[model samples]
Target chain A: MIEFDNVSLRLSAFALHEVSLTIMAGDYYFIMGPSGAGKTILLEALAGLHIPDEGRILLKGEDITGIPPEMRKIGLVYQDYSLFPHMTVEKNIGFGLRMQGLHHPERKKRVDTLMKKLGVGHLAQRAPLTLSGGEMQRVAIARALAIEPEILLLDEPLSALDPIMRDFFVDELRELHREQGLTIVQVTHERHEALNLGTRMALIRDGRLEQEGAIDDVFVRPRTRTAAEFMGFENIIPGIVSDAGGPDCRFDTGTVSFSCSTKAIKGENGAVCIRADDISVREKTDPGTDRDNTYRGKIVAVNPSGPMVRIDVDIGLNIVMVMSRKTFESRHLKKGSEIVLTVSPDDIYIISTGTPDTTCS
Target chain B: MTSRIKPDLCLISFALVGSTLVILILLALLNITATQLSDIPFLLQVAQDSRVTDSILLTFTAGLNAVIILVLLGTPLAYVLARTHSRFNNIIESIIDIPLVLPHTVAGIMIYLLFMQRGLIGAPLKDVGFIFEDAYPGIVAAMLFVALPFYVDTAREGFEKVPLHLENVARTLGATRFRAFSLVVFPLSIRHILNGCILAWGRAISEFAAVIMIAYYPMVISTLIYYRFTTGGIKESTAIAFLMILASFSVFVLLRLVTRYVGRYDDRV
Candidate 1:
C-alpha cells in the first residue's frame, strides 16, 4: 500500500498541489495528465527520489516520507529500462539481492525462478544490450521484483516503444501485475493506455487530480468538464439552464435549445456537455425513434478523421456528431445535406457554465 | 539520416600533412644511428645496463603512481562537474584542458615553480615532508602535471555519457545518490578511466623537460637518454634510445591487452 497524504512537491516547471491519494494493496493505479502536468513528479515523490515540499507519504500505513528510495522498498521501472549494461541478464535481475548482501548461489536461484516466470530463462547469460525491447522490460521488472518491493512504480514504461510493441508490453506488464499482486503505480499521459492498464485511473490537470475512478466509471461518466474534455471530447459550447423541469432541465443555448439531465438544475448558466459520438444523424422526414432530445439542422461540415468522420451541424448553433466510417458512408451524409441531430436526454449532461468558481466543487 | 558528402581539398591536404609530420619525427629520431649501424649489436649489449633498467623502472613507477592518484581524486570532481548547471562549469573545464595544449617545457617550469618550497603549493606540500626537488616525488609530480588533462577530460566525458535518465532510474529503483553513482556511474566509466590511464602513462613516459627541472636524481628513461647522449657520444646514446624503445614497446603492448580484456563488454566491435 502506498499513500500520499496531502503531499505537495515542487520541481523546475511543475508542482503538485496538495495531492493526497491512497493506493491500496494489489491496486494497479495510473495517474495521467498532459506533459508537464506533474505525473512524473508524483511518481518520483512516491519512490522517495524527490522529497515533497509538504505532507507525509505512507507505505503499508507507516510514514515513509523521509526514507530513501532503496530503503523505502519501492521498485521503479523507467521507460528505457535502465538495465545495467555491464551485467548479464541474470546478474541484472539479481542486483538488489547482491546489494542486500545475499549469497551468490541464493541470488542465482531466485533470479532463475524469476527468469522462468518472465519466460526469459534462455536469456540469463546474455548481456542486457543484446535483448529485445520486450525482453529488456521483463529483465527490468524481474530486477525490481527480486527484492520483493512493497510497491512498483513505472514511469511511462511503454512510451519509448513503437505502437505495436506498446500493446505487447502493456499485456506483459498486466500479466506481471497479475502474477505478483504487487501495488503498481503507473504514470502516463496516454488516456487509452491508462484506461487499458489501470484498475482505477486518476485524471490530473494543472498539477491537481481533477477526477479519479474505476476505468468504466471514469470513461462513461466523468465528474467535470475538464475530465470529459481530457477523455477526447473536442466540441464544448456554452449554454444556460433556462428552466428547471424538476426531473429534466431545459438549457437555452441561445440559438439552439438543449434538454439536460441535471437533478439540481436551478439558476445555472453552464456549458451543455455532449460527447460528439452521442449525437446521431438521420434524415428529417421520418423522425428517429422516440429520443426526446432532438434538433433539426443542416450539415455544415463533414470532416474525415482516422477511422471516424466528424460532422458539424448548425441547428442555428453549431454542434458536432462524430461517427464511424461505416455509419458515415451508410448515411450518405455530406456537408450540404440536411439532417436531424438526435441525443438522449441522458447524453447531454450539464457542465458548470463558466470557469468553475473556486468554491464550486 | 544523411545527405550526400562533398569532399574538400583542404581536408585532404591536412591529413597528408599529418602523415608526413609523423614520418619526419620517426626519421629524425633514427637518423643519428645510421652511420654506426654496423656496430649496433655491441651497442645494444651495452644498452642493457643498470642505468637503463633503473631509469625505465623509475619512469614506470612514477607514471603508475600519477595515474592511480588521478583516478582516486579526479572521479568525484568529474561527477560534480557533470551535475553542475552553472556557467562557471565551462570556465573550469576549459582551464583543465590548458595542460593539454601548453608547451611541455613551459609546463615543467610552471610545475617546478609551484612546488619550489617557498612557492604557493610547495610551501604547504613541504610541511607534509613532500620535498619535490631531485626526488621520486618530483618525477611523479611532473608526470601528473603533464598528464592531468587526459584523465580529467576522459573522466568528464565518461561522466557526461552516463545519461541522466540512468541515474534517475537508479534513484527510483531505491538506490541513494552514492549507491547510484557506485553501481551505475562508476561501472560505466571504468573503460573510459582505463583509456585515460593509458594516455596518461604514454604522456608521462615521453615527458622530458618537466622531470629534468624537478627531479634529476631518480632519472626516468627520457632524462636518462638525454643524460647519456650529452655525457657519452651518439653511439652510446643510440644504444640506450633503442633499448628504451624496445622496453616501452613491450610494456605498452601488455597494457593494451589488459585494458582490452577488462573492457571487452564496452567494445562495440
Candidate 2:
C-alpha cells in the first residue's frame, strides 16, 4: 500500500494543495485530470522525484518521505518511454539489474525473460531509436518491471499511441495487472482509459484532488459540481430545490425542472449532475410509464463515437444523452428529430456548485 | 524588366558569395603546396630534425592533455549553465566566454601574473612541488586557458538539447543521480562534447601568443615556428610551417572520422 498524507508542494506557477491519497495493495489506481492539473507531479511525487513541502508518504505503512528515488523501490514509466538512446533493447532492459550489482549472467537471464514476456525478445539487439512507438513502449514497460518494484507509476503511458494501439496496450496492461496483482498507479487525462483500467480513481483539478473513490462510484456519484463536470457529466443544470419536504424534491432550473431525490432544502440553489449515459433516449412515443423523470426534447446534435453515440437534446434546456451505436441506429437519431429521454430520479445527482462559474460575467 | 533585373541581381549575389569562399580556401591550399614544391628536400629535413619533431610531438601532447583536463572540469559547469535559469548563472556563463574574446597575448599576460612565482596561485602550488614556469605544466595551463571556452560553449549546447525528463525517468528506474547521468545524459550529449573537445584541441595546437609568454623554453610547435621565422629566412620557417599544417590536418581529419563513427546516433537517437 502507498499513502500520501496531505502532501503539499509549491512548485513554480503550480502547487499541489493538500493531496491525500491511498493505494491498496494490488489496486489498479488512476489519477484523472485535465492538462496542467498537477497529475504528473503527483505521480512524480510517488516516484520520489519531487519532495513534498509538507506531509509524509508511506510505502506499505513505513514512512518513506525522505527516501531517495533509487531506494524507493517504485518504478516509473513516462509517456515518451524515455528509453536509453545509447543502449540496445536488451541493455536498456538490463540497466536496473546492473545498477543493483547483479552478475552478468543472472542479469542477462532476467533481461531475456522480461523481453520474451513483453514480446520484444526478437528485437533485443536493436537500438531503442530504431523501434516503433509500440515497440519502444513495450521495452519501457519491460525495463520498469525488471526492477520488480512494489508499485509502478505510469504517467500518461498510452496518451502517445493511436486509438487501436492504445486499446491494445490498455488490454495488455489490464492482463498484466490481473496476472501479477501488481500495485499500479497510472495518471491520465483520457477518461475512457481511466474508466477502462481504473479500479479506483482520484479526480484532480487545479492542483487539488477533488474526489477519490471506486471508479464506478466517482463516475456515478461525483460529490461536487466540478467533479461531476470533470467526470463528463453533460447535463449540469443549475437549479433550486422546490417542494423539498419529501423523499423526492423538484429541482427547477430557470428554463426546465428535474425531480431528484436528495436532502437539499427548499430554495437551496444547486446543480443536478446527470451523466449522459444515465439519460436514455427513445422515440417520442415508445417509452413505457416506469421512468420517474421523462422529458420530450428535440435532437440538436448527433455525435456517434466508436461504440457509443452522444445525442444532445433541447428540452427547454439542452441535455446530452449517450447510448450504444446499436441503439442510435435502431432509433435513427438525427438533428431536429423529437425524442423522449428517461432519467430516473435516483440517477440525478444533486450537489452544490462548489464554485460559481464567474468567467462569463 | 524589373523582375528580370531582380533575378539577375540575385544570381550575381549568389555567385559572388560562393566564389569568394571557394577561391579564398583554394588560394591557401595553392600557397601551401607551392611552398612545399619550392623545398621538397627541405620538408623532409624539417620532418627528420630531432628538435622540430620533439616540438611537434610536445605541442600535440600538451594540447591533448589540456583538452582532457577541460572535459573533466568544464563539462559539469556547462551542464549547470544549461539547466540553470537564474541571474547568477547568467553572470557565470558570461564569465566563461571571456577567454573567447580576450586577446591571446593579453590572456597570456593575465595567466602569467596568476601562475608566476610569488603569485597567488603559484606560491601555493610551488610549495606542493608543482612549478609552472618553463615547464610542460605552464604550456598546458596556457593552452587550457585559451581553448576552454570552445569546449564549454559546445558542451552547454549539447546538455540543453537533452530533455530533463529522461534523467528523471532514469532515476526512478533505480539509478542514482550520477548513474543516470553516466548512463543516459552523457551518452546523449557525447557527440556535442566530442565536437567541443576537437575544437578546443585544435585551438590549443595553433596557439602561439599565450604559450610564448609562460613556457617558451619547452618550444611547442607554434613557438618553434615563430623562433625559426625570426632567426632563419622565410624558406626555413615556411618548410616547418608546411609540416605543422600537414600534422595538424592529419590529426584533425582522423579525429573527425572517429567522431562521425562513434557519434553516428544523431537525430534518430
Candidate 3:
C-alpha cells in the first residue's frame, strides 16, 4: 500500500498541487488525466525521485518521505522502456540484481525466471536496439521486477505500442496483477486502459484530484461535471431538484421533467449525468416497456463503431446514445428520424450546483 | 534526363575545393616521406640511436600518462558542467577553455612559473622531493596543461547526449547515484571518452614549444626533432622525422581500429 499525503511539488512551468491519494495492496490503481496534467509528477513524487515541497509519503505504514529513490524499494518504468542499451537483454534484466549484490548464480536464476515469464528469454543475448517495441518493454519490465520492489510505478506504459500491441499488453498487465498480486500505480491519458485494468482510479484535472473511488462508481456516478466529462460521460443535462426523496427524485429542466436517483435537498440546482451506453432508443408507441424516464428526440447523426451504432439525439439537449448494430438495422434508424429514448433512474447521476463544471476542448 | 550527364554544380564545386585542400596536405606529407625514401636505411639507423629511440618512447609514455590523468579529473568536471545549470557553471566552463586559446608558449611560460623551483607549487612540491623544472614531470605537466580541454569538452558532449532519465530509472531499480553512473552512464559514453583520449594524446605527443621551455634535457619526440634539425642538419632530422611519422601513423591506425569497434554499439545506446 502507498499513501500520498497532500504531496506538493513545484517544478519550473509545472507543479503538483496538494495532491493526496491512497493506493491499497494488490490494487491496480490508475491516475488518469490529460497530457501535461502533472499526473507523472505525482507518480514521481511517490517514487521519491522528486522531493515534495509540502507533504509526506507513507509506504507500508512508514514515512518514506526522506528516503532516496534507491532505498525506497520502488520500481518505475517509462513509456520508452528506458532499458540500458549498452547491456544485452539478459544483462539489462540482471542489472538491478547485480546492484543488490546478488551472487552470480542466484542472479542468473532470478533473471532467467523473469525473462521466461515475460516471454523475452530468447532475446537475452540480443541487443535492446534489435528488439521490437513490445520485446523491449518486456525486457524493461523484467529489469524493473528483478529488484522485487514493494510497488511498480508505470508512466504511460502502453502508449508507445501499436493498438494491437497495446491491447495485448493490457491483457498481460491484468494477468500480471492477478498472478503476482503486485501493487501497481500506473498513470495514463488513455481512457480505455484506465477503464479496463484499474481497480480504483483517480481523475486529475489541472493538478487537482477531481474524483477518486472504485472504477464503476467513478465512471457511472462522477462527483462533478468535469469528472463526468473526463470519464467520457457525454450527456450532462442541466436541471433543478424539484422533489428529493428516498427512492426517486424529480428534476425539472424547464424543458422536460424526469425522475432520477439522488439524495439532494429540494430546490437544489444540479445537472443529470448519463453515460452514452446507458441510454436506449425505442419507438414512441412501445407500451410493453415500463421505463421510469423517457423522452422524445430527433436523431441528428448515426455513427457506426465496430458492431455498435452511436446516435446523437437532440431531446431538448443533445444526448448521444449507443445501441447494437443489429438493433439499429431492425429499427431502421437514420439521421433526421424521430424516436424515443429510455434510461433507468439508477443510471442517472446528479451533480449539485456550486460544484466546478469545467469542460476541456 | 535530357542531358544524360546532369551535374550537381554546387556539390561538385564544394567537393573540388575540399579535396584540393585535403590533397595538398596529403601531398605535402607524401612528398616529404618520398624525398627520404632513398634514405630508409639511414632512417632505420637513426631510429636505432639511443637519443632518438628514447625521445620517441618518452613522448608516448608521457602522452599516455597525461591522457590517463585527464580521464580521472576531467570526467567529473565534464559531468558537472553537463548536468548543472547556472551562471557559475558557464563561467567555469569558459575558464576551462582558456588553455585551448592561449598560445602553447604562453601556457608553457605560465606552467613554468607555477612549477618553477621558487614558484608556489614548485616550492611546496620540492619539499616533498618531487621537482618539475627540467625533469620528466615537467614534460608531462606541460603536455597536460594544453591538452585537457579536448578531453573534457568531448566527454562533456558525450555526457550531455545521455538522457538523465536513464540514470533515474537505474536509481528506482535500487542503484545508488555512483552505481548508476558507473553502470549506465560510463559504459554508454565510453566511445566518446575514448575519442577524447585519442585527441588529447595526439595533442600532447605533437607538442614542441611547451616541452622545450620546461624540460629540454629529457627530450620528447618534438623537442628531439627540433634539436636535430637545428644542429644535425636536414638529412639527419628528416630521417628522424620520417621515423616519428611512421610511429605516429601506426598508433593512429591502431586507435582508429579500436574506435571503430567501439562505435558499433554507439547508436544502440
Clash count per candidate: 3, 0, 0
Show the colliding residue pairs in model 3: none
lDDT score of residue A112 within candidate 3 = 96
What is the alpha-carbon lDDT for the whole of candidate 2?
Answer: 0.87
Model 1 lDDT per residue over B1-269, tens place? 89978888899989998999899978965774563466877766776688788888888889999988888887887888887667798898888888888888888899889887786888898999988988888888899988888888888788888877677766655567898899888888877878888888888888999888888878888888888789987777777777677677788899888877774454431
lDDT of 3: 0.87
Q: What proportion of the real contacts between chains A and B does each prediction keep? A: 0.47, 0.70, 0.77
lDDT of every model, 2 decimals: 0.81, 0.87, 0.87
Off by over 4 Å in 3: A224-226, A235-260, A263-272, A287-305, A308-361, B1-17, B38-42, B84-87, B227-239, B266-269
Model 1 chain A scores worst on lDDT over the 10 consecutive residues at A352-361
DockQ, computed on Cα atoms, for candidate 2: 0.58
- Residue range A1-361, candidate 1, lDDT tens digits: 6778888887766788888877878889988877878887888788877888899998878898888877777788887888888888888888888777789989889999999988899999998888888888888888888888868889888887879989988888888789888889998878888777788878888889887778777776677778878876665667766777567777787888777766535557677778898877655575665636777788888899899998888888888888998887888878888877788878777776454222211
TM-score of chain A of 1: 0.90
